[model samples]
Target: MADNDNRDHNRRDRDDRRRNADGGRPRSGGSGQRGYGADRGGNERRDWGSKERRGEGGDRRSYGDRDSRGGDRQDRRRDDRRSSGDRDNRRGDSRGDSRDNRGGRRPTGARYGQRGDDFTGGPRSGPVRQGFREERMDRRAAEPDLPEGLDLADLDPLVRQDLRVLSKDNAEAVGKHILMAAELVDDAPELALQHARAAKNRAGRVAVAREVNGITAYRAGEWKEALSELRAARRIGGGPGMLALMADCERGLGRPEKAIELSRSEEVAQLDREAAVEFAIVIAGARHDMGQHESAVLTVERMNPDRKDDSFSGLRLAYAYADALAQAGRTEEARDWFAHVVAKDEDEWTDAAERLEALD
Candidate 1:
């Protein structure tokens, strides 16, 4: 009885080892899990080597199957469709050569699946197409022509070089308008402003074009426009030239306080001799505009106007001093300074001769 009992126990142990709770032998692979397929009872699991079990009726999709198989199938289908269409286009064939050849349908007839416009085999009409073309032509014709006075050949070589940022053809066209603007600035300043605007529209990024626009606007007394363009030019390329003009524009707009503030900025201190003289003149004018005539005279007097130098800046400095004195009610001293200005006014660039005669 004892030997029979031991043999029975050993047989029971072998049975447990060969069969699991689900009634199948352990798999031979890693972790000895079950197969990927499901049984009729919907209790099957995969050999993913993890303890996690799927919920009841959970799908049997695996991560590797979805990524490697599904992704590659999708990519290959897309490539095949593209390559087939490209081959059809290269062959220039309309018949059975098409990727989706629908019984050799002709390419030029009613779009394969859609109805033609009039059943006469023509493109469908939407908005009046000709009307758009006509409107575009009218817009082109209505645009203002570049001024006839524009002549790039007349500009100095250095001046022309400033437009090198633009293409050669664009530079020449914009350069012409700039030259025309300069030519008309004195006699017809408003027209000069128009020319300058044309150049700026063509090459708005060019510093020289912006400078011309600002200067022309200043000449035309368009104070707001001058200030904006000059400020833009200065931001693009820092130079001391625009400071005085910008300050004067401030005075033009009845902002003498702002003008004074700008004149005293650090940039004004670094100005070259010509810009410095112009800055002084504008500052003095701003003081006068604020009804501080004595202060204006004092500002100009600080320049120490010497009668010896006949440079343009020297002449302008002297003239500003004389004007400041006249405006300050010091007529005798004003006349003496004006006389000094007239002696150097050979070209008569300023109205110094007329100013002295008026003082007399």
Candidate 2:
């Protein structure tokens, strides 16, 4: 019984082992866990290659995926490096190029662009445009150091004409500087003489010096000195007013006969109507001063009645004529002449009020 039992158990165990060997199901504990394709040994011997081949086949797919991934990573890294390096280069270039350009600022218009050497399309005068630009910059930079209220003296005639402001070419500007000097001497006679002397020392034939000296001598009560200057002024070819003034000085020195002689000279007769009128008035004043009242009235009557001049020479004669009439006790006629003086003195005849009051 024991032997039979042993035999049955051994047979049953063998059958169970055979069924397990032919079942075609994977092991439960480690299902499908294989190195590459090693499970199909001889039946698919082409698939069951060496560990190196199997590993290569499996590793080829893994290597292909890894290689593709590695290639993408490498490309990304290259792009990052390229973008970073490019960005850095751009930033450095921007910083480096800013210092060279200043007022004439442009991105591409400087050396090799639109302003290609500044000598391409037209002929470039050497250093002219650049020098002018540099000079303007230098002038603007130096503006604070320039003197106040001082204008740059212009020598350019075309620019001066275009602006039409004040022309330095006319030389009136030179007189403007001395205008105050002339006015300062108007009241101070001694200083005026010194100023005239200094001006004469600078250049001969200075009309300004002659005028100032003559006027100062007249003011200082130097009658003979005044006459000397007046004569000198005439000899030096003074203005027409100076001739009138010379006659006046003669009258002032109590030389009525000499004044009459000078006024009625052949030279005086040859002058224009204006000058003749002035001379006639001077003669009338001198005659009146000499107490020749009738002669003074007749002197004005001898003048042509039509002409006029800015000196109002006729007005002076009219006043003197009224005075002479008053002196002669012709009261009614003197009043009429004084009234006429007031009526006709629209040009502001000197001593108009005094002449009118004499008539009243």
Among these predictions, the greatest TM-score belongs to 1
- Model 2, 1-360: lDDT tens per residue? 999999999999998786555342333223322222235451211211122331322321211111221123333544665565566665655554433343222234554345433312222224456477776556444322212353324323432222222223322322222232254455765555544444333222333434555766676656666667666644443234355556667877878778877765556645676676667777777887788878877777777443243246666666666666777778887777666666778766556568667456
Query: TM-score for model 1?
Result: 0.58
* lDDT, each prediction: 0.72, 0.51
- The TM-score, computed over Cα atoms with residue i paired to residue i, of candidate 2 is 0.43
Record all residue pairs in model 2 with backbone atoms less than 3 Å apart, i.e. clashing.
Answer: none
Lowest lDDT 10-residue stretch of candidate 2: 61-70
Worst 10 residues of 1 by lDDT: 47-56
In candidate 1, which residue ranges exceed 4 Å CA deviation?
A: 1-153
TM-score of each: 0.58, 0.43
**Leading candidate by lDDT:** 1
Cα lDDT tens digits, model 1, 243-310, are 99999999999999999999777787768878878888999999988899999988877777889978
